[model samples]
Target: MSKHQKIVIIGGGTAGIMTAASLSKQKLKIDILLIEPSENHYYQPAWTLVGAGTYDFEKTVRPMENVIPDGVNWLKDSVVGFEPENNCIVTKFSGKVDYDFLVVAPGLVYDFSLVPGLGEAIDKGVVCSNYTDPIHTWKVIQEFKGGTALFTQPTTPIKCGGAPQKIMYLAENHFRNKRISDKSKIVFATPGGVIFGVKPIAETLMKVNERKDINLRFGHQLVKIDAKNQIAWYALAPNMTEVNPKELEISTNEGLVGIHYDMLHTAPPSVAPKFIQDSPLANQEKWLDVNLHTLQHTRYQNIFGLGDAAGIPTAKTGAAIRKQVPVVVNNISEMITSNTIGDKVYNGYSSCPLVTDYGKMVLAEFDYQNNFTPDPKLKQMLIFDSSKEHWRLWMLKKYGLPYLYWNKMLKGIDV
Candidate 1:
């Protein structure tokens, strides 16, 4: 068994499943093992609508048996540890399997406990994050029928930068349509100074917030939550810093502050997985050490990674998986055959279709660099395109994208 040609993928989600399909479709007669802990695979992008009441929760999840490529062995367990040095991994099930190559794309885990009181608040119903399991987001939204419905963005990099605000916008829209708009006060508290990373889209979001009358708080970090009292505490950003040769002072910094809330939507900080973080393949920030261009492990050419697990400095989105899959596939193919590989850089490309209202969206796309410039001119770009409202985007998200994801992206078929 150990003598066969094999490629072991560490996850069965977007990257893992797609990579397997890509390889198998090429008629590569090799042993492939997919290690995933859960039987249910989630299309996480649609969770925003589920929180908003636009989409049903059941629609976002699919059985793993349906998504894993045929001819690949699916191990329904997690990689408890990785022995990358020996070209193998130890899974909770299926024991230790050696491989000719490894593709790590285990996604990410949300550490709610990192923030004091956050876990308690989430459990108690005062605070809920759409970025996590999302089972309780609806409850949190309903509980906030009035008074201080707060949404927050943390200091760490999140999966979808727009997700926190998207949930907020959806909730606001729901309130408006449900005749409860006057009761709830929507407040967006973000650690970032801007509403969005992309500037043009940020301008539009600012206008939307103004029109919706949602309060925007910038550079505020959520440090704690009081579930019993429905109060949240945060450290506000400093106004300015003064530095001298001998010392530096943050004079305008304010005291840690507390605010009352009827409901809260939180986005927790994220980091690389523990296994990758502990391995020598991690970079300075402890993310998977991969070449920015090839998506191949910097030190180990036979190793590659994508999705949130990869240390590439890009907006972590499923759309990112679409781009990275090609790079990893091509690079790994070249490495196996000992050929001069062509360089294919990801350009940090990721997209967050902002659902500003029930039927309006500003598609934001950009590279790893902060330069979030969209295609110079799309066929349609304006606020007045009412026919193509947020609902169309919602349809794309709910109905269209999933098919494209399962049949096209995961199967490695270019559509």
Candidate 2:
């Protein structure tokens, strides 16, 4: 190892910022540089609440400089490509920025182009998505007169998989409050067969769906949208080829399932940023090719990837990154000192606060292999099982988590 080493992190979002904050806390005599173009940082997990009109959208953003740790060199530039073989990265304006170690945390990008009409349809008329604009989503919800409200997600991995239904649940509650539930129907379409990956959470979500009278259109993969006609079209998901032949949702003539909706909430297809797909670091799926447990680049020993762009099989939520940040930081420290990984390994632990109603939520905490691992704090606080809906979990989603994120997590305090 050299007498002085520099760590360069790509992206100013949660993963990069958290990694930088964590590294800075280590007080290592290492030069740290963060390459990011955005001047504003967003606490995106709160965007779900924003769309539901429970959270202030203005509060989710902060100046990039505010969240960045002190002493870390901030290179306000975008990454265009990488020269990993040479331990340098190509930036849009700065050209090549060399580093002794690199952390790829640029996160993923929404590819609305993947769906034929989504690019033109999103954030317009009744087609609104929190991923695009939470304010627009709130407006759409307010203007909805109540008919068929369709919510759907693509088969591709997306940040916070529970977001689609979270908004749906909120909207249903709103409709019921307005006495429109009798005249309105909530339809949730998803490619996955189960409501959630973990068995216990899945069961609970199933019961919530039933209780809310939501029509679950499983095995449906949204393919296109006709905004003019207000019809969302879906094809059978690749993994769901064996769907029941008697499924009435199928349009026999077109071989597609068409749902006429008054309102549409879409969780657009998310993919690794184009630069990552073009770079050598991406896997066949165009995601960061990192070890699932170690989070180190499969081919580059000095590189680590986390956050939404990582190809970890777990749900990409803030809680997942919360668990992953320490592993990356500790492993990097270990490598710098002993030239090897330490005992720290991320077990794919991720938690999603599933808001089932206006004031109730279910906390879905699980690890790799879809094993349910509820938070011990729930038991400590006498909150009992997290698989079932509780008001305290809702409070966490609305208040506690955000407080922890800004004051503790981003400050490098392990909460």
For TM-score, the strongest prediction is: 2
* Residue 288 shift from truth in candidate 2, angstroms: 0.7
What lDDT score belongs to each candidate, Candidate 1 first? 0.75, 0.88
Task: Work out candidate 1's RMSD over C-alphas.
Answer: 5.5
Give RMSD to native, each candidate.
Answer: 5.5, 2.3
- lDDT tens digits by residue: candidate 1, 1-415: 3244688888888889888888887644468888888888888888877777667788788899988888989877777777778888877667888888889898877666667778666635667887774768877776666777878867777898889998888788778877888766787777777787777677778788877888777777877776777777778778422111111111222477676777888887788778778877789988888888788888887888899988887888998888888888777676665544546767788888778776556677777776664544333433233222345555556676777876798787754
Q: Judged by lDDT against the true structure, how good is candidate 2?
A: 0.88
Worst 10 residues of 2 by lDDT: 241-250
Question: After superposition, which runs of candidate 1 have C-alpha atoms over 4 Å from their true positions?
Answer: 1-4, 133-135, 239-254, 372-394
Error of 2 at 232 (Å): 0.8
